[model samples]
Target: MSAFDDNPFAESAGVNPFNDPAVTQVTNSTVESVDQYNPFPATNLASQTTPASSSPYQPAVLQPSSEPTPQATATAAQANLLRQQEELERKAAELDRREQELQGRSSTGKENNWPPLPKSFPIKPCFYQDFSEEIPTEYQRVCKMMYYLWMFNCVTLFLNMLACLAYFTTSSTYGVDFGLSILWLILFAPCSFLCWYRPVYKAFKTDSSFSFFFFFFVFFCQVVIFIIQAVGIPRWGNSGWIAAFSVIKLSKAVCAIMFIVAILFTICAVMSIILLKMVHGMYRRTGASFHKAQQEFSQGIFTNKTFQSAAAGAASSAAQGAFQANN
Candidate 1:
């Protein structure tokens, strides 16, 4: 009865489950581990918080920027502008120098070479002539031909004088022809050069309508004179075909010479006609007109220093006379 009445799960007062050898061993080990383990250690905390060096603490300093400053950038831009301005000024100076050189060459720099006389000779060259420099390439051929024609005419006149001298030896009545031949040579050579040749040269150089018109008038007269010389009129100071034929009875040499002169005159007339046509064609292409020529003539007259001085003097005299008359 006593054994059945006692509970099977009742704890025994002296027996503790926690006081068992295995449980006591586990509790002792856990207590020792809990004491040894520390979440915050002195060495690890110091390594994390402190710097590697032993130097004193200082404030952080900012390094200089690699980018250019505003002032520096502005200075660079100004320097570039100054350099450009200097370059422009240098170029302007060069252009001015070139312009001055051109003006000098065009006006007074070059010396006269025409009439090509020696330095030791009494007479100096009277004109400057450079077809290649002053005249256009298209007009050079015509200009040179005209110059050659002038030279040829001079030669013909000299030859005519010789022929006339020979004829004079044949008869005293031919003295007038010899004298007139000398006169013609002396008068015509310089006059032709000044009147027709110079006018044509200036016309080509400047493309002046006034010069062109002047050349046409003078050269036309020259052509007519050439035709008259070719006609060989007696006592007219010409060695024409008739004069040449007449001289044949006197001296065959004189006749031959006069015939050559007559032929030269005919050639001059024919060449003048052809050249006139050519010049006229060129003038038409140049767009020059009578109105332009008139303007140019008037302008030239007004701009002439001699004309201006004369006009001023005349006005002054007229004013003085009127004032005296009124007084």
Candidate 2:
């Protein structure tokens, strides 16, 4: 009727395209699947509405470090000092051990051939050994003082030679003193170095009683020499008080020079005495004794090839002589 009112298909289907029963069933199934996987659930709405500061999301506050107190700083310094002291003691012990090993090697008659020298070389290179390095820390200062004294003595001796020369030029009578001064310088200089200085060095190095006693005996003689030199006896090589006054009548300039040398000699003597006392105290602490010295001397004597050879020769001669006499 209105366009033949409706076809038969149009009458069966709805006017809207979406009104198809198949499409409606598909839409309902898709919505049900989406609802099963909803990301923002409604139960968490209350937590999301709360302020961040009032919630568990607040940042942690940082605390500033406090300054150390005076007492704490002092304690730290003391601890550092103690650690340093311990390190020094450890180093000292290590050095002592090295010294002992070196001594042991020396006593065994073994030679160190490091950096081997050419056979054609005239002098053997023994420069690697330094006995001074082996001196103990407690005695190092005194040892250095002793070395300084030796140097002073050498200087004084040299100056005395000059003073004596000056006096000889002024007065022919003083020529003997000048000649003797030369001889004294020659003899005492090397002798003192070999006898007292080396022995003291070895004593401190090895705590050897023989070296200690040897040094003491030799240095005692040295002290006596200093006194005699200071006294400036006539015909003596030293330019002492007597020489200075005796030459004053000849030349005031020469007298002044001699007096100055004498003063230096006297100072050296006084210093030597003081240093000797100090060294003696240190020696006592080392427990060096005459008994130990005797033992060392005996050992040294037995080890000496010259002595052994001489003894063997003497014994053989005596045996031969006795056999001949018996025959």
Candidate 3:
């Protein structure tokens, strides 16, 4: 102490505390203790969570691409999707049934087998027809027959005029004959013209079965009467049957000409019968039978490409709207 006391620093402490090798270790321990004992939550948390050599917050590793958590959510969503799909399918089936019923009802009396009837129009009353397709072909066939009948009657009128001209021009002898024949031609010309227009008009305006029967009846009887009159018979359709036998004496040439005219009229009558058969066939093909109409309606308009597309589009839009509403 006598030697060391010679210097004041030696008395204070033989060395500087900062220069001591153990001082750094002591300082570090103090810092750690201070952090652990911190009143601040952040400092306490950092001290408790961190390792000596590591950061306070742990860094997560990269996850595998095939994470199963999302799949679990997806599976639950798929179940919901399946339930929605079944509901949509049920609605679609119901819609299809309704459409079939509407189509069937539109065409046939089988409407009773359909769904409930529709109510008032959704839009304005005058906006749309809400119309349906249901035209019976029998009526159309009748119109077509009337058209054909008119055409044929006009053609027959032309032929009748030709016969009259031919009879006058081709005759050999004419004393009082031409004058008598002239009077006969003048009188009957306008009357015979009625055969062309009247029958066609009757067929068009009136579809009475009795009228058709009467036409066939009266016209055929008139033909026989006219034939007797051509032979210069005093009374037609009478007990004077043999009187018409004198047609043989009517200049064999004229007799032959008249017979040819009768043959032409016969051809026209046959043509009308053929046309009647044709129209009847077309009518039958138009599903005139109730069962046939129902079957055709079931498959025809509903299955039409335009209608199918419209139905599909409507269904899609409706489903989309429902999904949006639910969401």
Candidate 4:
């Protein structure tokens, strides 16, 4: 019974399988290998596998962009030049159209429209005046104002004649005033139109220095004449301030009419001064000078066929007379 209870396979007291050298060595080796080994290593397998002649692994880096090529820069410049050429061509076409329009107008021999009289009237229009066609857009306003001023002056002159006629009725001593007023209306109206007004118009239209100078000279005289007319000196023919007040006691109706004429004269003087200043300012802006005026005047004289013919006839007549006298 004792032998059966005691087994041969059973371990002795204090002797453990786990404490054995072989088992302990195997377990320690496994733990040491686990501690030393690393699943994620810093070493590069590609670098190690590659041959010595191959380059080492490196990170990709972004490079700075290179400058534009000369051909590409030239292409951009050519595009700009082409755009400028197109603009120049467009401007040239516009200028050609304007020239053609001007030529067409001249070639058509357009009828005069100024004075705007009816076809039934005996006196035909003497001039063709179109502000829209002739005058530049920038100068049209001032030019139109000048035309209105001329018309106003004409009306004032006509009123002055009427006033003088009434003054003559008041007294026979003022008969000369009435006569002179008629002469003034006949003379100054046309003279003023031809002299200062026409010169100024030509100045603005053609930008002519000669025309500008002529206008300045003639308009200054006109302004002086206006002042003299406003003064209304006795026997001067103008029914101005002095003439109006002189007839106040004789006939109040005549005095009132003369006073109105005097007022119109004063207004004319004021307007002339204002327009003169405005024209002077515009002249300064236009770069007009006495030298340019002289050159333009000489050119105009030389270019005129009438002047050339007169000069030639005079020269020939003078030579023939001298030859005859010598003979």
Runs off by more than 4 Å, candidate 2: 1-132, 318-327
Residue-wise lDDT of candidate 2 within 121-232, one digit each (tens)? 7755442334245688887888778878887898898999999999999978889999999888888887887799878887887889999999999999999999999989
User: Per-residue lDDT for 20-101 in model 3, tens only?
Assistant: 7688667766455744775765555755674755667667898787756987989989999999999978977876675665
* Better structure of 1 and 3 per lDDT: 1
* Per-residue error (Å), model 2, residue 227: 1.0
**Model 4 Cα lDDT, one tens digit per residue, 136-187:** 8878888887888888889989999999999999889999999999999999
Q: Which stretches of candidate 1 lie over 4 Å from their true place?
A: 1-108
My TM-score estimates for the predictions, one after another, are 0.67, 0.60, 0.25, 0.65
Instruction: Report the C-alpha displacement of residue 273, candidate 4, in angstroms.
Output: 0.3
Candidate 4 clashes between residue pairs 3 or more apart in a chain or in different chains: none
TM-score ranking from best candidate downward: 1, 4, 2, 3
lDDT of each: 0.87, 0.83, 0.48, 0.86
After aligning candidate 4 to the native by TM-score, how far in Å is the CA of 127 from where it should be?
1.1
**Which candidate gets the maximum TM-score versus the true structure?**
1
Q: What is the lDDT of residue 199 in candidate 1?
A: 91
TM-score of 4: 0.65
